[model samples]
Target: MAQFDVEAFVDRQKIGRPQLAVLLVCLLVCFIDGFDIFMVGKIAPAIAEGFGEPVEAMTLLFLCQQIGLAVGAFVVAPLADRFGRRSMLIFACATFGAVTLASVYAQTLFQLSIMRGIAGVFMSAGLPMALAMISEATPRHRRSTFIAIALAGYSTGSAASGAVAAWLIDIYGWQSGFWIGGIVPILCIPLLLFFVPESLKYRTERNPKDPGIARTIQRMDRSVVLAGDEVFVLGEADGTARKAKLLDVFLEGRTWMTSILWAACFLSMANIALLAAWLPSFFQEMAGIPIQRFAIIALIAYGGGVVGTLTIGYLMDRIRATTLIPFYYIGISVALFAMGQVSFEAPIFIGILLFWSFAQTGGQGGLNTLITQVYPPRMRSTALGWSGGAGRIGGVISPIFGGVAIAQNFSLQLTLTCIAVVPLIVAVLVFMLGRNSYARQAVIASVVTQRGTA
Candidate 1:
């Protein structure tokens, strides 16, 4: 009887149409995800104006949405491990879209916040699932790059939200942003259903008898022939034979490492979410930059994020991520300090904003990629989801921080400086993680070498 190692075959194959199709589908999902999630923040001032409230009043909206996101990441995303990544992803897209569209009809900020909170539950599935799908589909050598390329779509979608707001908010009101965000994802459902395949590794582990595995392998490589009676394997030796449990993330000497990751994610995401939620309002209120002008600046800055995402992904493939990601966070601190100093200077501030986004958004991308590498396929989604869910605690806190700063009339310099501190802390945590990861890799390499010599 013929035996096949599914993961080995995937790693050996070159990037082809099948791989590209996976990337494309993931890219679109990420793009729409970024667009919807960031749209409210991008148009916050407009939404506040429409509701006849101070912009700071939107804090509850941000909080509710984030809490829902935390819940979804913790609860909903892990189900992908059992149910299927593709199916869960499609359901998330459809439900999130419908809820987001309904948000446009909300008559008050409170109502909108409730709707956004509901939408957030479904929206939270996008990134982790996209990362898991892309990671499983691509070759091991190029995994980070493929994940990065898909993430660029997320950056693009985020930037696009600012652009769309700049164009549509004044003409069609804030609802227009929600309208586009909602409609696009619902429309993409057909494409996801038809083009994206479930992770072959997932199918193999969950039900080795699944006939779809044979069909998928054939699609991945048209030239390969498979017998109907072949025995399939994942080539994983570490307890992947059984169903994955959440406890698996902490097993295998991962207890300390998981704690470190959760801490780093908490700090890093707090900073990112705070900035995403309030940067537009910050520049408008503190820097006295007009909303329209800042919108254009945001587009330019988030473009830097796209570049950062791709660059980090490429470098991670070549360099140790432990060594590379910390520098990005350090750069964030420097950029934030420089941004505080140059608040009034458009040319200098824009440059600083670019670097900030490059590091901030890109660094977040790096963290996401690292999570994918840390766990085995059986529990990868659970690890990603739980770590992200932990981070959402910080995300939930960020809006309140921003709101407090705005209410207390904090100086722009103080606010930016305070924000700078979090990234520096994150840098330290990432460095520690790097050391731990390096030590583990070294031990593994030594064992492999000794076994070979013996």
Candidate 2:
């Protein structure tokens, strides 16, 4: 009987039409996911005006949406392990789009919150599943870059939400942003169904006898021929085919690594959430910056995020992630500290904002890439989902923490200095994770080498 190592074959292959197709489709999924996730913040005021409610009334809506995101990451996303990433992703996209579309008709903030919360449940599944799909498909050498490219779509979509709101909200009403965010994903469902292939590694690990494996390999590279009866394998010593469980993330000497990753994600996300929720207000109220000027600065800073995202991905491909990833976080710490000390009127403050966004947003993207690298296929989705879920808890907590600081009338320098401490902690945790991952890889390489010699 013929045998093939599907994992090795994929690692050896160069990027081709088939792989590019996967990347594009996953990018679309992330774009829409980001659009929907960030749209609520952009249109909150318009929605409040329409509902005859104060803007503060939307706090429940934000809470509900965040809680839903946490639940989806913890619960809904892991189902991809049992079902399939492609199938679960398509289901998530379709349902999230439909619900978000329905939200335009909501008569009250309560009703809208319910719809958005529901949408969040499905929306949360898109990015991680997209990451898993792209990570499994791309060659190892370029995996981080490909994932980052796909991730940029999410950031782009987020920026596009503001642009859509500025353009369409005033003219067509707040619903216009939802209209675009909703219709686009539903439209892309056909593209995902037809163009995106299921993870070949997943198929081999789960059911090697499946005939689609042969066809997928042929499509990826037409030169390879596979007979029907051949046994396909992933060929990793630890990659035993079995039912994936949530506990598996903690098993296999992953307890410390997983703990460190979760802590890093939590701290980093908390800092991000605090800034996202309070930065505009902080600049306006404390620094005496005009709201309009801060908006412009914010827009310019987002551009830095895009540059950072792509830059980190490219660098990660060439550099050791342990060194590069933590360096980004440390840069975030320095940027945040400098922001506390610098004059807002200074031209250099703009540069600080740029570096802050570059490091903060890019560092978060690096964390996602690192998660994909650390985990194996069987429990990769679970690890991503759980780590993200932990981060969401931090995301939920930090905004409230910022609210308390604002209520206490805390000074800008003090509040920012407090926030600056988070990334330093994250940097330390990530550094430890990097060392652990390096040692683990060394052991695995040594074992593989010894086996080859034997």
Candidate 3:
């Protein structure tokens, strides 16, 4: 009987100073993501007054930004796979920052909307690229953990953005939010240039799969078979190399499963983006809370998400990733439904918020990890980003719908309850997908065994 060595498990990823620096750079980039996305919500009221426009008009702006994100994700992410991860990320960050800063000088509603939309397009590229880079940089076994940790920065950024916006909106006005958003990424440029190395796994040669994929497959063989029943999983690169392409996900072995997982990505991320975009405004408007207080409540939501994310990681390490995801979705749907019904009663509201946060935010993290694991390295980031990008469409739509419901004098309770249905449907979809994923993995394992015996 042998014991598990966690350190050795993690160390195989070769996550030294340079990789860690990449993580830090990713954190800064996500920080900008959190700040800018939420900044729109935080300053929505101010923007309305500044332009003397209705909240509904502002909601359209939110939708436009998300639309830009979806386009970027679907169109831009695949290019990262085609080119390289580091260049895409650096360019994405710098583009978003410079564009966002330019947004500060806009004088009209149209200008602000266009600038914000452009910023959204660029910022959208950052998350997927970062996820791809981190996955490649870390060892295979420890990839999810590193990914979860890296993603935590997004939540941290979300939390900090609220606090920062709460303070800055008073002193510098809504434009200041974009100013900070732009400036943060500008500062990240030096680090990205100096510290962030190109992903060791990304290819420079014409035959990208030649040595890299072969070497990874060799490592895999050593760890899984040669190492005996030790479950010696390679976190970074195994000795074996399997050539990976976007189409390979479907054509080779697990196409059905990949599609299912992509659907899960859509559901899980849609819920998170929807909430991140709308929850604050909903609380302030329907609950009749002040901006500062609403920010505090937003913190609570993010806090619950943090708990959920950590909890998902714990469950994933012990149990199958696919098996655990559906349960989280069920919990999220229930919590969101309860949120629709709950009043200002502190205990009840808090419970709703926590559940909603955990189920959606945490659930998203879990889904992301599962996606990263199921796909081969080549298409992993693109899949996650594209799926997430598609989910952003839902994010954009949810807030706009919420705003419409409120404007129409639709009962807040009814609107919120309706929103809960999206998660419920998503939970069912993901559960079905999870079952498919498990089935697919079993099939793959059986096929491998058959091949080995032959």
Best by TM-score: 2
lDDT of 3 by residue, 1-454 (tens): 2222222333354456756787788777776776677678767887877788887788668767877788888777766776677777777878899999998788877788888888888787787778877766665545556677767778777777677556887888878878788999889888878876665455422243333434433443345322322222233333243444556556655766766666666655666666665666676677776656765665667778777777776556545665677788778778766776777556778777777777777778877776665665567667777777767766655556766866877665676777777666766766676567444474344234223332
For residues 1-454, what per-residue lDDT tens digits would candidate 2 score against the true structure?
6678887788778888878988998899889888878888988999899899999999999989998999999998898888888899889988988998998899889999998888888888888888999988987767778888988899999999988778888799989988887888787778778988889887788876677889888878889977678777776534345667879888878998989989998998888888988888887777788888988888999888988889988877766666788889999989988998899889999999999999988999999988887787777888888898999999998887777877898888988888888899999888887678543573344234323432
lDDT of 3: 0.67
Worst 10 residues of 3 by lDDT: 224-233
C-alpha TM-scores of all predictions: 0.88, 0.95, 0.79
* Per-model RMSD to reference: 4.0, 3.1, 7.0
Deviating ranges (above 4 Å) for candidate 1 = 45-59, 105-110, 238-240, 278-296, 346-348, 402-414, 437-439, 442-454
Candidate 1, residues 1-454: lDDT per residue as tens digits?
5667887788778888778888988898789878877777768889999999999999899778888899889988888887888888888889989998999899989999999998898788777888899988887767888999999998788778878776988899999988887887787678778877888877778766567888889977889888798767777432134577868778877888889889999999889888876877777777787867876676778678888999988777766677788999999999998888885555687788889989988899998888887676777788788889988898877767888888888877888999899999988987888678533473344234223332
Model 1 scores worst on lDDT over the 10 consecutive residues at: 445-454
lDDT score, candidate 2, position 117:
88
Query: Which is superior by TM-score, 1 or 3?
Result: 1
What root-mean-square deviation over C-alphas does model 3 reach? Answer: 7.0
Q: How many backbone clashes can be found in candidate 3?
A: 19
lDDT of each: 0.82, 0.84, 0.67
Kindly report which residue pairs in candidate 2 clash with one another: none
Clashes of each: 0, 0, 19
After aligning candidate 1 to the native by TM-score, how far in Å is the CA of 416 from where it should be?
3.1
| Model 3 alpha-carbon drift over 4 Å, by segment | 1-15, 48-60, 204-249, 273-296, 340-343, 346-348, 400-417, 437-454
